[model samples]
Target: MIFAAILAGGVGNRMGEVDKPKQFLTLGDKPILIQTVEKFYLNSRIDEVIVLCHKYWLNHTKDLIEDYIPNAENIVVVEGGELRNDTIMNAVKYIEDNHELSEDDIIITHDSVRPFVTHRIIMENIEKTQEVGACDTVIPATDTIVVCHDGNIISDIPNRNYMYQGQTPQSFKILKLKECFNKLSDEDKRSLSDAAKIFVLNGEEVAIVKGEVFNIKITYPYDLKVANTIIDDAKLNISDAETGEYKVNLYDFGEE
Candidate 1:
């Protein structure tokens, strides 16, 4: 089974003076979390959608889903963990407890704030993870990457050609991810920046899936403004096909 884990564990500390967490904040018409969920829910390739939400907002998350999504039996809201990776583990644990586990099963983890994620990115993540054991979505770095060991000065400057900014749906073979995660020492686990780092530290190969620049995470107030503009443009680009399915040309927002 292919599961898409939508991580909504953040409390929106950076988004100062908000009534609720940033995920619950309205993006265009619906909450950012709901829009993110719908992206996966609408895709026929994904079998299940698991929402890992912070404990404090769990009920609110459930209520929002119930109100917005019709017949959302496949989508489940579970309590997130203290850490980002731990929240992902919670999703894995939920899957193991409720459903049959298999070695080949895939879990695609994504940030709930990134509502602009295109269907193409989701499909590529699944396809690449099936081919390789793991994959991370990223885009080429447009600026020179400066490595600063200390806040005072830059230790080294890396070539921009080799540098890429990381993004999610970081996907992995479910069993393989669990095995790699288990091998990590407690200290190493605590220091992890993201799940793909586990594979890197374990000498495992992780393939790359190209990500869109418009696949931005809503972290601050300014981002919400940018997201609204993107939504307006997306509406302009949307059109109906002969089969009666609505196709959104997110590429019009510089996705390619």
Candidate 2:
């Protein structure tokens, strides 16, 4: 059985929303986090989904179920911590505390604001990671990349040849994840963006899985506009098909 841990712990400081976190922010009508969870639940490979939400927003997240965003049966809602790594660690503890998951049971770690994650991506993540230790999704960088410093040209233009932009829906074997997280040190607690980074730092190599371009993360206000355009285009495409099924164009919109 595969269990999903949808990481909804971000405060979205970059977007600067004082009212609520970006995950709880409304995109059209549904909450961003709810849309993310729905993607996992819709996939047949996913058996259960556990949401790591902020404690203050617990009641609000619960209300979403009545509106058909999250399925309450296979869903397990838990409180999140301040830091992203803290939240992830807490969620892991929640799993370890209550039940003992076997080695074969895979766990997918994904962000909440990234609601555009597709069923195909979800399936591929599981497929790539189930056999090998772990798998991460990334898209090739579109523009020429460079590293800069203090308005000064610190580094020259980087060859975008093999560089790719990294994103979430990173999946790991339950046993491997448990092994990695189990051995995390104090410095590991300090450095925390990618889950696979911990393993990589400890000398474990990870496999890369190609990701869809439309699977974007909603960070700033403009991103919402882009997402709106993508959503509308998908709506029109499905409407034109004449079939009842809604088939969305994955990664057709903006330049990645």
Among these predicted structures, which one has the highest TM-score?
1
**Cα miss at 177, model 1 (Å)?**
0.5
Q: Model 2: clashing residue pairs?
A: 214-251
lDDT, candidate 2, 106-219, per-residue tens: 778898878888766777889888777788889999998888876786576778997889888888887777678778887885786788786786677677877877889999
As for model 2, its CA RMSD to the true structure in angstroms is 3.4
TM-score of 1: 0.94
Model 1, global lDDT? 0.91
Tens-place lDDT digits, model 1, residues 1-256: 9999999999999999988999999988999999899999989989999999988899999999999996799999999999999999999999999989888899999999998888889889999999998999999999888899879899999888999999999999998999999999999999999999989989999999999888999999999999999898676556433335645454345434
Local error of candidate 2 at residue 215 (angstroms) = 0.7
